[model samples]
Target chain A: MSVTRAWAWLIALTATSTAVAAIGLSGRWLALVVLALAWAKAELILNRYLHLAQAPNIARGFALGLALFMLALTSLAVAIP
Target chain B: MTTPQASVLDDLPGDLMMWVLILSELAVFGAGLMGFLAVRLTDPPGFAEAQAHLHSTGAGINTLVLVTSGWLAALALEAARAGRRARLRALLAGAALLGGVFLFLKAQEYADLWAAGLTFESHAFYTFHMLLTGFHAAHVLAGILLLGLVGWLATPRAVEAGAAFWHMVDLVWVLLFPVVYLI
Candidate 1:
């Protein structure tokens, strides 16, 4: 996608995330959704904004790292408290 | 002169150093997030209470501003690639201006928090909150200066590098929002 179109998606996603947070979600469900959304937004930036998609290996590596990181944090938040 | 495609990266868009900076910055932010999580999970009640005082409106506004600025930086990079000097300069300046807006809003947020007597010692949560946002703000400041310097230089490599750094800053804030403000 063109930079403009990618940016439009980012802004729209931000608005959606903000709205979701504002409405107040709770428990493990909230943790799951919020972490998932954050992961998706980060992926969007890495893939589109940073142009990492051109190098598939680098892109996959970064995605895996982010997934692991978010999974750990989400687990800590949801599993324990 | 070798065209950009012949410049060794073959697939990447910018210089090696900018990628290094990007990776390092991400690592640092990742560590910070982990640290914040460590403390937060320890005192869930304390953190949640302090977190409730946080103003998501400002965080959300800053998110919108930073993301838009990151787009402007991307456009500047595109213009640089196309050898559109004037467009590149204009986009860089616009991006820098938006970065300034981000800083202004961030400062306003900090000032409000301080006015309300939330300091680094206010609580463990506030400490991490201040550190994470403060460190990220420093990056935004550095990025604004880099954007202005690169706009004046107008070199494709320099401009792309600045765009990379600025976008990295935006990306950090993107991850930080849910962890620090909402969650």
Candidate 2:
């Protein structure tokens, strides 16, 4: 993707999260959506920003690490709650 | 222009040292977040109430601002790859300027907290709130300095390393905004 397109995605994703916050969902639902969006945004930056897409293995590692972090965060907040 | 040549591992960008720094920083922030979660779980009501007093709107806008800065840094990296020396410097400067804006907004938020007399000793929530964000803000400061240096130098490797660090700063805020303020 072009750099411009990548930036557009970044802005759009941030807007979604801001809207979600404004809407004021709480507890596990909020946790899930926010963390997931954080993961998505991080992934986009890893690929489009860092140009890690060229290094597929590294990108996958970062993606998996992000997924695990989000999962751990969600489980800690939601499952135990 | 730096071609973003893969490292010996063939899966990394920029210097291995920068990635190491990024991961180390993330680990530190991650540990802080885990501590925060533990505290919040113990006292959800107290934590949520404290969270309610925060300027979530400023944080939300800051998230956009920081991400936009990351986009600029990414464009700078692209410019480096394209051998556009002037564009690289310009984009890095823009990214650094946005970083300044992020700091300015955060300082406004901080001023309000100070005016309200909240401190590191105020409460468990505020303690972590200030600690984590304060540390992240320090990183942002470091990033802005690096961006300025790289922009001035206009060298590909410097630009790539600067972009890497700046993006790492942006990534942390993106993760922390919800954990610290909204959620």
Candidate 3:
């Protein structure tokens, strides 16, 4: 997909997920859904929009660390209740 | 004027170290959200009552401000890519102004909430409200500082990094609005 198209799709997905998560879900489910949408948006920004594919190894490593951190936090939250 | 041949990522300037710095700031906000959630689950009534006091319209307006700033910052990035320094500056300034407006509205909301007896110790939700909004307000303040610096520097890389930070700020609000207002 083109960059513009991909961005639009990502935005739509985020908006829908946010609205649903906001109005309908709660607790672990809400956190999980929001986290999933956040992950998707972050990936779209890093991979598709920013084209981190060409980024330096160090930057890529940092991005990977960020992803892991987000995953860990979200997992802990979900596991709590 | 000759355009620079640098890739967007390559030209990203200033303390590239600031990216991680900004990420650390985000981690602080994330911690606040996690704490707020934990407290909410533990004391649902206090949280629910505290949430009821929040002005959803105000929260919605703040969310719009951050999102608009993000959009402007994105446009500024594109302008920087095209090497239009004037347009870039204008957009950066616009975003900064929006950030200012957001802060102003947030301060007003806090003042009103305080007047209405919604102190940090008032209830569980109030604690969550104050903590979450306090952390977010700090981010907004940081964003305003970054936007000001971007306006001053006007370098392509700085603009890109500024856009990244602004987008992150916007993203956090996207989560916060729901957690604080709707949910």
TM-score of each: 0.93, 0.93, 0.73
Question: Lowest summed-lDDT stretch of 10 residues in model 1 chain B?
Answer: B3-12
Tens-place lDDT per residue, model 1, B91-154, is 9999989989988988888888899998999999988898999999999999999999999888
The CAPRI-style docking tier of model 2 reads: medium
> Per-prediction DockQ scores?
0.60, 0.65, 0.19
Residues B1-183 of candidate 2: C-alpha lDDT, one tens digit per residue? 777765546557788899999899988898888788878888888888788878998998898899889988888887887999899888888999999999999888889888988777877999999999999999999999999998888878989999999988988888888788867
DockQ-wise, the better of 1 and 3 is 1
What are the per-residue Cα lDDT tens digits for candidate 3 across B39-153?
6667666666677777766777676566667767777877888989899989889989999999999899899998997788888777777777887788788888988888678
| Candidate 1 CAPRI level | medium
**Tens digit per residue, CA lDDT, model 2, A1-81:** 876787788788878887887886877888888888888888887787778888888888888888888777767667435
Comparing 1 and 3 on lDDT, the stronger one? 1
Model 1, residue pairs in steric clash: none
- Report the C-alpha displacement of residue A50, candidate 2, in angstroms: 1.3
**Model 3 off-target regions past 4 Å?**
A1-18, A21-32, A42-81, B1-15
Q: Give me the runs in candidate 1 sitting further than 4 Å from their true place.
A: B1-10
Candidate 3 per-residue C-alpha lDDT over A1-81 given as tens digits, one digit per residue, 9 for 90 to 100: 444554575557556555765576777777677667666655555544444544656456646866785676576556544
The DockQ for candidate 3, computed on C-alphas, is 0.19
Fnat, 2 decimals, each candidate: 0.53, 0.57, 0.01
- CAPRI quality level assigned to candidate 3 from its DockQ score: incorrect
